[model samples]
Target chain A: MKELYNLGLSEIDIKNIIETYPEIKDLTDEEIAKNIEILKNINCNDKHIRNILIANPYYLNRSINDIKSLIMKLKEINIVNINLLFDSNPFLLNRDSYEIDEYIKKELEEGKKLEIIVDELESNPYIIDEK
Target chain B: MIVDELKRYMLEYGFNNEDINKILAVYTFKENEILFFNIKKINTLLETLGYTQNDIVKMAKRFPLLYSYSMKNIKQKIKDMQKLGYSYNDVIKIIKQLPAIYGYSIEENIKQKIKDMLELGYSYNDIIKMTKQLPSIYSYSIENIKQKIELYRLMNISHILVEKATYLMQSCELSFARYMFYKNKGIIIDENNYPKLFIDQLKFKRLYGIDNKTLIQMYNYDEYFSKEKNVLIKI
Candidate 1:
């Protein structure tokens, strides 16, 4: 818990993160520190960062550069609520970014707002059914 | 393998290839995903019990939750229900009417519910009768059940009100929003009247002086700090 605090996780964030992924209870303090660093590097807010971490605990293990590039792609496609996007579907990280990029383009073409598209994507990352 | 079998099973249930593909695409149930619960095992059990493919499709579609449920948990629930003197027929009826209950942990969730019902001054037979009267009873969490019960008790609502109209207790966002809206207006629901104060959308509009969409917005917003935000919204 102290390690999580040192990593800048608020009490509520730590509580919710643990609640969402109890398996993270066994994560070493070093692993948690790494997760904090990866999230902070992406300029994610504490709450939003917690949402991302809770949704995809594996992000803790991923190279910071991998997550950094994916987040950049998501931003370029106008995902207003990047945290919500991850919170809605953690598997977004595992899925092919090219497929997600194409889906975002289609949604944009349909005249949907960035927030709406992000909200829908959060719930249905495979809305385009990109296999 | 499980996905293939599920697709085949859905096809056997008369689902078109398009329907099968759509459902499989939306619901993530790959072969490795069913490690905790074998889909084939439930299929065999349900088939042996004489449930047609149509029945399974209806149950699966309406509830949209089966792959996550373990056969062991479901069997344990059946065993628990039988111990309570409910026949297998009764259990089937319960599941058919409300499939979501099939996923609830019998030992943890349902046991706590039965305990809450008992605490609410309902007898064992009365509880069974309540279940029959309202299939929605199984859908509520025990905490929400207790919260509503506490609020009802505060407002002097009778146990019979809860016993008869099960919806009076279930607290979804819309329901809770409506509750706050009406309560603020000092609109006390007539416990004796069916659709007493809140029947349909029209009644909601008439009583609350708000449109359905706005009411839905309020409901949606309650996903945050409900009690506090509701007061702010009302003001």
Candidate 2:
């Protein structure tokens, strides 16, 4: 928790995260610190970074390479608020490039504006699930 | 001082020395009212569920959210599933597979979905099996799930296969274009290979005989994939 505290999460952020996902306690300081750095490098806003971790406490469990690819995938699609995208679906980072590309292409084919698809990605990953 | 205080606190709640040690082992000792409150809430919930001391410690370490959820909400989520035909033990197992199930809004997400599935001739046993196999299906709205089902029907995908392969199929990340593109090229979206839709763009194009330039053109043209109807093979 102190490691998270040092990485720009406030006392409140740490407390809220722990209360939400106590398994975060087992995350090593180094592992969490690395993910924090990865997210910071991609988005660079403390609040956004905190939100990503809070929404997807499992972010620390993914490889940094996987996280980077997810960020790159969104950047490829020109999404402005990458943090918001991650916040809605932390699993986005775990999705392969094919999944991300197909999502964008599928929405475009249905006459959905690209921006709307991006908006949905950031708003609720649930909508993208196959019904 | 805080550790000492927490030990006394848990002891008062009928938690034994072993239980206190287990809880302390899973968390860093921080002196805060909310933290202790959460610890108490989590312990009480687990005890009522008949979790052994060892099981509580393990669950706490592996899935801390188990401890943080309001016991009331957890019970409600379980009871709701029981009403949907899963036994109490089955509900417990489902939550273990998808802890986030407890976080879902039942009325908005779960209830209508079960009702809709039943209307479509899916039995409670079938739905429960699907839910257990693909716990994330609970995340989708009833309409969203129906739309996907409708797409399969529209494409003339085998009805038997759709029902038999639903758990794996429901979770694929494929979209309408990807689905039709493969169908146009004589590729069936099977439970095994439907994931091709989620493959790397270049590899998918190469594997399925589509081209990047055409896809890019389709992507840029924007309004529709093309002006002509059924131009899916144009790729």
Candidate 2 per-residue lDDT, tens place, A4-83, comes to: 77656656445555654566788788888888887777654554455456544655666577567767787887665555
Assess candidate 2 and give its TM-score to the true structure.
0.46
Q: What TM-score number comes out for model 1?
A: 0.51
Cα-based lDDT for every prediction: 0.54, 0.56
User: What does each candidate score in C-alpha RMSD?
Assistant: 10.8, 14.0
lDDT string, candidate 1, B1-235, tens digits: 7656666766876666654543454334354345314545765666666566666655554433444456676777677777766788887777765555665555555665687878977677877777765554554433344545554554455465445645442233334555556666676544554244335444555665775446646555235433432232321
lDDT of 1: 0.54
Which 10-residue window in model 2 chain A sums to the lowest lDDT? A122-131
The total of clashing pairs for model 1 equals 0
Which pairs clash in model 2? A98-B198, A98-B199, A131-B145
